[model samples]
Target: MPAPVQLYVYDLSNGLAKQLSLQLTGKQIDGIWHTSVVVFGKEIFYGQGISITSPGQSHHGRPLQAIDMGETALDEETFNEYLEEMRQVYTADKYHLLDNNCNSFTNDCMGFLTGGSIPSWIKDLPADFLSTPFGAALRPTIDNMFRGPAQGGSSAPSSAQPLASSLLQSVAQNATGVQGSTSSYLPTPAATPSPPLAASSSIAGPIQICSNTQHFNNLLSTHKAVIAFFTSHTCPPCRIIEPVFERLASEKASAGVAFAKIDLGSAYGGGQIASVYGVRVTPTFLFFMGGKKTHELKGADAGELKAQVDLLTYQAFPPHPHASLPLRATRSISLEPILFTQSVNFEAVRSRLFSFIDLSALSDERKKSIENSITSTIIPYLKNKADEREGKGKGVNTSISSGAVCEAWRIASKDLIDNLQVKDIFPLADLLRLTLLDNPVAQWCSTTAAASGTSPPHAILERVASALRNEQQIPKPVLLTTLRMAANMFTQTVLARTILVTRSNGHHTSLTTLAISCLLHDDSLVRTAAASLVFNMAAFYQAPRMEALRSGRRGEAEEEGDGEWEVELLSAVLEAIKMEESNEDVLHRLVASLAFLLHLSPFYETQLKPMLEVLEARSTLLAKLEGVEGGFTVSKKEARALLEEVGTKLCG
Candidate 1:
């Protein structure tokens, strides 16, 4: 029978939002909604993590309304198992006020149970508040308020405790409950009631709690292999083998393998589960593969259980194709970005930049302003950075601070970059590129640009990209400097690399677009820098793919646009590979970039494989390896090997 699910909505503002919302936000929001899912005889809500009680018994007290949210086909046991899986996600520390609060959890549950969503008005209150001017001003304060005392120096909102006087009365009123225990009718949460079980984020270790047949069947269907331990509480042998089962689960439970425990005599549908599998004895272990029972053991034998589990795991996740090839040198290629570390005459670069400003067709006031900024702020900071790099002043206090450098660049980006003629932008860009090599400056610029604001944090990079795209014939120096700047962005921090590679939005200004444009440039120097840029981007994309292949699960942080970027990058590199001829260094970079983009790709069969076949990627790579006049020299051997591996292994 399908169970009815209701949405219990509460007003956390306790009636204050009705009076103040109109004056504060210029919108008439009735209440600050806190919601919970009441389903299968329990009221589940997320506050300091997930909590559960009988319907109408939570501290939030009788809901503003119990909305009929339709019914769920899932049995109680199946839903309980689903809630167990959700524990790792809806953790205490992950809770937030405006973003990921009680309403968010209930909406997720509502969708899962009924294939429907909560009312949009209830969920859109935060958006409404931020949409107004006064409310927008108070966003930082509101955000801090919910981050808790540990993080934001403010205590979390106090959840109202259930009144002591109502405890006996509430229990008496709800005597007939799910478990038919007097304690089940009480307002207090059940024992295993905490939502966020402090397990490692992805790998939940101990043997999973299995209380129903549907969820167990769901587990068997999803995993490559499953081990079900059927045991009885009265059996001494069952107790002896329980620790071994837990150890195996802790060691082997992953996306591919699942470990579950079903007590055959416990109160929660255990006898039904036992009867379904025909498990007539205590300590009976059943192994399933491809959703069929493969092996069954009846004893407290730890050795047999461990052996069977190991064999199934080994069969499920076979070794990767790359493991068979002798491509250790190819796979071990350094991922560090190729930097423009050649020391330059800083004084000469500074002098020429100022000279360009002096010679430019601008007002004297504007010229003086640029000169003062360069002299007073930019130059000193660059010198201090240079000194830090060369280890010149080890202990002495450098007068130019990081804050001053940031302020100087802030002015340069907002005031100077846009106003200057395209010809003069290069010198300023070149100077700024050198400063970006410093880790602090790079991290600040990368993270700030991701913030929501009117002013872009990386305005100078934006200006450089704009000039590169708009100009009909760019000077070689400007082009080379721009490519080098793009390549150098991969250094210092992962945030910078992620921002550069995964940030394309159909804009010519994207760093990915910039790299593709300069890839097959007429100048080999420009091509080399462009290749480096592509290599950096490819390496960033490939790192997680490699880890995913190893772990059999994708990370939570991976973006949806990754597949689109991969296809785009692979297409551009293949075109560049066919056109690349004379310079072995350029060819090496191009070949290496292709290898990183293709190796261990999760979408190889669906996306990359067909694309590779269409592009004749194999023949193209073979031409690079064999068609070389004398073949690659011994020093360039890794490049040849990498090309061969990509053609034969990855392209297939």
Candidate 2:
């Protein structure tokens, strides 16, 4: 059977409450009175905070009106839990004279118990009382008189609280027409205060008490995983789970999984945090990883709580088998040249490329000179060099060389960079794009060895990279084009090695970070380009390493940074797949990259399972794309098959 709910309202006076409002604020008002919700014959009330009192004794006089709020579907346990949550929010310290007084509490109670709020006229009374010029001017004095220390007591109820109480009691006694007895309804103070909740012992591991939202968020960010226990001092279930919570904290301390208990009864703003998470019960547990809430459990079931804590701890601190693996297995793989099969339209590209260049940014004669230098001089020079190299019976070198074409590239790059403005950057990028379309120059730049002791061909490409990095206000087209050029340079084995294998100042400027940064770019085209670049790098270089790690020679040097670079790359790919705007091509490439990275990497499988689970849950999308054709260069059906195959391998 549904629980019965009733709304009981009391009149402040026959009509004196209205007269007082008119005198103080020069505005007529309805009678002010106290209100409460009676649930299942028990008067469940929230004043400064939540309380329970006898039903018939609540109103000093007969209520002005008793409205049936209808029955509630909530069971006794659910109702009590909701009340406990309300107690946290309506704590004594949080009450205000005009903003969050008893009326507000009553409104909340009504909404929860009956799925309806009290009338707006009753709810907005306090605000109406304070809105007048005279009322506003007298507020400070009235506030001080009522809010100062209570006579013979250290604390005082705000003016609104006492005013409501005094008027209700006085009028109840004098008004002959009222129905009930005029007895005081104020709760008798307890003779002995309840003992403070025992603090969880440090021997069982320290349980941090988060006092505010910022503190809780900071803890989440600092720890790899966190278990937040929301407890209340007055709740029996919360107390019952305390010891078990502490025990698990102690057991998992060494694993770097943080344990925290929030006293919703005592901690300031604790209720606000609970509200943010939609927690409406004591002994609620929240599990967070990487600043996201991954799991939640409610109730005081110790066995279930312990099991969840164990699972979270295990995931937070997984065993590292890579520690025992060979250095050869973990080391980066060798780089290789990426050959393009698509036919190029050189004249069409050159024409469109020059059209976007900002001639106004350059002197007219200088612009003409620059155009002649790249097209008339640089292009012809590169073509001639490529022909000469081919005539000499030399195939492409394994390393980039600082030759005539390389020198000419450097000069042309410098000219573009010196005069380049935001508008001109796209044209310059397009120029680089056109240069790569010339197969001979592309092959020469990609494979030739650096002229002894000089900068490699890849180094010339850095001029463009540097310009993009340094210029903060670059247009999206320019940035996309620049990234494309860098990606194009990486197709060369030597350049790929330079970017991926070689460290600059002990830090790898990873293609993973670069590609991930652009994944969120406002322009879809930019995101597509970034996704394509990531796929190319991962497919060519990183994929083979995973395969070799599964079946190749072993070596030493077991100690290294936890594969953060690999994790970052994998995370980026997964994130791109999850994005709402990720097109079929982007998803295809991203999944392919993920498949390559997961191959034979047992450690990654454990770390990546959560994200993979998210993808698996979206089975509809996977099924839809299973036979749909279109990818970086393959059909969606092929990409889906590859993903499933890798997923099976990882599972095994």
Candidate 3:
């Protein structure tokens, strides 16, 4: 038995409190919390609830946000059963046609679909969708009966409340503004709807389940084990454990262990279910026997998950007590090799993606052919191009605008991001393993301190070094691009070691570095990159050559941001700057860097006088430029601030 199940939900949208309590109290029970609240870590849009309280017991809550999965602690296994049942209900006796109540008449009465916004495909329905034979059949419940022969879905929703108002609300609310945030906004589907049930009237326990608190109080008197498998479709661990839970559901339903699963959308818009549950990571299993949760499993793998489930299943669940796991700080191994290989498996992924595009809707065979051609050739072509731009190709110029280049990057992008997950790669496997063991900040808030994107620059450098040492011959373009990207990405202190290995006097001959130094590039971004690289020069052979350039003792053909001012060759760099004290922007930023250099060596007396003179000159020039107020604001403020700080320190 594990420790008593304890969850710390940060947001408590009380929408599903009732349904939640009931499903948890009974064995084989399930609940769908229609939390209007946003989601977290992932999406939380599963709106129906279900449970298997005792044979005679039952529970109910608000009209489901979507499907009305019956009462039970919903798990992957039982959820599938619910879908099958809904499908059967949809396929079976047309409730409107049944003699129960409808006269095929005024039943067109206003029906509120109430939850998610309707899907776009709804507009494609036939004109008579409301009054036609299909309409007449489904009019009583949903309206136009087109989806199937009967059940309420095929029918057109009545005119009083059009389909537009109700069907797709969930989908639209979570939509993203950019392709960047798209996956983060996707709604995670829970266990698929179960196979159809025999009849609405044939179930032993109450089929309709809800999260109402009142119903919850009444459910505790029955059943043995009620386990809530709070999960999400976006979670990697959840996928791993879903089948395991499914098997558990099948083997233990009659044995008295109940299951429930909730999609915690806390990571998205801060969905209430996740907020209330305080779910951060996935595969959180909360087990309850009688009315209270007895034990829980946090971060369970295959073996641990089975063990946890077994511990909670039979005799009253146990309470596990243990010290915190030890933390490890070193992150040496990587998961990149594995993930990249998988991303290149374009054929398989492409096939699966297109399988969802309904072919029946594609009318023109020519159009279909075009679609196939694009997917088969164009996409792959563009992807290869993007890889080349990213330095994945030999002897290719760095090009960001190539459509093929973007497409290839997207290929890597899609493979890495399978839903809310970044697939497991061996290179990252140990890195994540160790980073997580020691750094909580990196673990919980990855974007802040943890680096992840196409690839971290350090990781790329490491990959390059590894290949050179063992694999095929190292490509110069790959090495050069990696260095440029490294300078652009990490702080000097962070990438210092890697910078040493690849840079040398020969780097001047490297087209990659020369390309980066072009005057046409954005001055601000490129300047910052160049400075950062200069600050960390411990990697190359003949380090003093760089130091001599920096000191003005040796002058190279220098590239400036705007235009270069010609100067005679000098032995040290201070002389070059002194000789061209003409450009304001150049002087301002150099003065800015002086403070940094002073950090290493004190700016005492004799040296301070020259620095002060330049600072005063720049300040006067900038003040003249600032006469128009905000016109030259960046330079104006920067120059004045630079002088003020230097003067203060000198005086101090």
Q: Which ten-residue region of model 1 has the weakest summed lDDT?
A: 156-165
Runs of candidate 1 exceeding 4 Å displacement: 1-244, 252-320, 352-373, 394-397, 421-423, 453-471, 497-509, 548-564, 613-616, 625-635
- CA displacement after TM-score superposition, residue 115 of candidate 3 (Å): 15
User: How does model 3 fare in lDDT?
Assistant: 0.30
Q: Any residue pairs clashing in model 2, and if so which?
A: 399-448, 399-449, 400-448, 400-449, 400-450, 401-448, 401-449, 402-451
Tell me the tens digit of each residue's lDDT in model 2 across 1-652: 8887887776646666753443223345667656677887676544424556567454334567877878888787777776665564555433334334456567666656665666666765644554432333233333333233211211111222333344444543432112343222233242111122232232131344454465466557556688899988899988788888876764453213567667677533477678889987898999987778999999999999988877776576554344344333123323332332232344564565466444446666666665665665555543444445557433343233335445556555545565555545555555555455454455444333222111323433344445445655546866677557656754433334334544341113534444777776778777777877776666544433332233221110011113566667776766666562436666656655665455444345556555556556245234434434443333555655654544444322
lDDT tens digits, residues 540-611, model 3?
111222222222211110111111110101011123223323344544433343332322121223353454
lDDT of each: 0.63, 0.52, 0.30
- The RMSD of every model to the true structure, in order and in angstroms, is 12.6, 25.3, 26.9
Give the residue spans of candidate 2 off by over 4 A: 1-369, 381-402, 434-476, 505-510, 520-525, 543-551, 556-562, 580-582, 601-636, 647-652
After superposition, the stretches of candidate 3 with alpha carbons farther than 4 Å from their true spots are: 1-221, 266-274, 317-652
Task: Report the CA-based lDDT of candidate 1 relative to the real structure.
Answer: 0.63
Best candidate per lDDT, number?
1
Q: In candidate 2, residue 442 scores what lDDT? A: 55
